[model samples]
Structure formats: structure tokens, C-alpha cells
Target: MKKLHVVAAIIKKDDKILATQRGYGEFKGLWEFPGGKIEKGESKKEALIREIKEELNADIKIDKFALDLEWQYPNFYLYMSCYECSLESDLKLLEHMNGKWLGKDELDSVQWIEADIKVVNYLKENL
Candidate 1:
């Protein structure tokens, strides 16, 4: 099985978590944290910074590894790392169709990708 390693940002401000809606691909319109696949020779942190810049057009300071989850989908096995991140500005949705800062109680309001829904549930229980 091919391994897909992705870094996701858990950007929290005023107790709300930032979530993006995918604009294209297999998961288009589904909500997920802003991040992307690790490219060759890039460190996880480097991939994260690059991804956030590419996807959200905002600079982020990664604090720590918050969670790691294995997701088995019909097409791929995904290994995702969630990191606590602080954003420097309001995010611009460069690739996503929409974005929102959702409070814990409103997490279920948006339809999330299956893999990402696990992360949301985890956050609800722990954060």
C-alpha cells in the first residue's frame, strides 16, 4: 500500500478551529484542516508551512504535534499529523471554496471528509 503522509493545522483563535472546504478532487466541498501531503525530502514541518501558505495564504507558527491518526479509505491509507498552529492573518481561501472558524459546538454543522471527522471528534473530547 502506498503511504500518504499529510500534515494538518489545528489553528485555533478565540476557541474556534479553522476548517476549509475542498474546492476540487475526490473530496471536494468536504471540510478539513488546512495542510497537504509531504513532498520528497521535505521535513513534516516544512511541508506544513508550505501547505498552509499554498492553501490558506497565511503564515503559521507550528507549536507541537497535537494528534496522529490512521485513516483507511477505499482508495488510500492516510497518515495524518495534526499540529497546533497560530496564524498571522485572516486566512484567504486560495484553493478552498469556503472556510470557517467553527466553535466546538458547531463542529458538526459542516460536512467533513471521513478521515477529518475523526480529528474533529478527537478535538471535541480532548480540547
Candidate 2:
């Protein structure tokens, strides 16, 4: 199976965390965290910052490691690292079908992509 390495930001403001819906691909309309693929030679944090800036036009400060997850789909294997992050500027979405800031009680309410559901589960247990 092919493998994909990515970083996802669990962006928090107060008790709320940010989520974004995919606007393209098989994951279209599925909610997930706000980061993306790590380019070759780019550290996870560096790729996270770049992905957030590209997708939402906002800056973030990653606070700490949240989750290191591996999930297998029919077509690909996901190797994802998640980080707890904080917004550094106003958000301007350039990609994504929708976005939301959800409190912990509302975290599991959204329909999350498979990989991100693990992050949500972690938040439920630990946050």
C-alpha cells in the first residue's frame, strides 16, 4: 500500500477547536484538522505552518504534540502527526467547504474523516 505522511493542527481557542471540511477528493465534505502533507525534507511543524497558511491564510503557534496516528484505508495508509495549536491571526479561508470552531462537547458532533476521528477521540479522553 502507498503511504502518506501528514500533519494536522488541533487549533484551539479557549475550549474550542478548529475543524475544516474537505472541498475536494474522496474526503470531500468530511471534516478534519487544519494542516496537510509534509513536503520532503520539511519538518512536521514546518509543513503544518505552511499548510495552515495556504489553506486558511492564517498563522498558528503549535503548542504541543497531540497525537501520532496510523490508519489504513482501502487505497492508502495514513501516517499522521497532530499538534495542539493556537491561532495567531484572523482566518481567511481559501480552501475547504466549511469550517467550525467547536467546544469539546461538540467535538464529536461533526462528521470527521477517519484519521481525524482519532484526534477527536484523544480530545474526548484527555481534554
Candidate 3:
């Protein structure tokens, strides 16, 4: 199986975290934390910052490492590194169809992409 490395930002504001619905590709409409694949020679943090900027048009201050998860999809193995983050600017959705602010109690309210469910579960337990 192919292995993919990605970074996810659990962007928190007050008591809520940002969840975005995919606007394109195979995972369209599925909810996920707003970040993307790490680029060659980029540090995870750098990749995460760039991805959030590209995807949401927002800057973030990374607070801490939240989780490291490995999940198997039918075609690939996804290794995701999640971090707690705080948004530094207003958000403009460039790649997501929808965005929501969900509290810990509401994390399960959406249909998350398979791999992101693990991150949600971690947030539910630790938030």
C-alpha cells in the first residue's frame, strides 16, 4: 500500500474547533480539520502553515502537537500529524465547501472523512 504523510491543524477559537467540508477530489463533502499533505523538504510545521494559508486563507499559531495517527484507506495508508492551533487572521474558504465551529460535545455531529474521525475522537477525549 502507498503511504501518505499529511499535517492537520486543529484550529481552536474559544471552545470550538474548525471543521471544513472538502470541496474537491475523492473526499468531497466529508468533514476534516483544515490542512493538507506535507511537501518535499518541508517540516511538518511549515507544511501545516502553508496548507492552512492555501486552503483557508488564514494564518495560524501552532500551539502543540496533538496526535500522530495512521489510518488505512482502501488505496493508501495515511499518516497524519495533528497540532493544536490558533487562527491569526480572518478565514476565507478557498478549498472547502463549508466550514463550522464545533465544540467538543459536537464533534460527532458531522460525517468526518474516515481518517479524520480518529482526530475527532482524540479531541473529544482530550478537549
Among these predicted structures, which one has the highest lDDT?
A: 3
Off by over 4 Å in 2: none
Please provide, for model 2 over 1-127, each residue's C-alpha lDDT reduced to its tens digit, 9 standing for 90 to 100.
8999999999999988998999999999999998889999999999999999999999999899988999999999999999999999999878898999999899978899988888999999988
Supply the global lDDT for candidate 1: 0.91
lDDT of 3: 0.95
CA displacement after TM-score superposition, residue 7 of candidate 3 (Å)? 0.2
Q: lDDT ranking from best to worst?
A: 3, 2, 1
Residue pairs with colliding backbones in model 3 are: none
Candidate 1 segments whose C-alpha is farther than 4 A from its true place = none
Clash counts for all predictions: 0, 0, 0
Q: Candidates sorted by TM-score, descending order?
A: 3, 2, 1
TM-score of 1: 0.95
**lDDT (Cα) of model 2:** 0.92
Pick the winner on lDDT between candidates 2 and 3: 3
- Candidate with best TM-score: 3
Candidate-wise lDDT, in order: 0.91, 0.92, 0.95
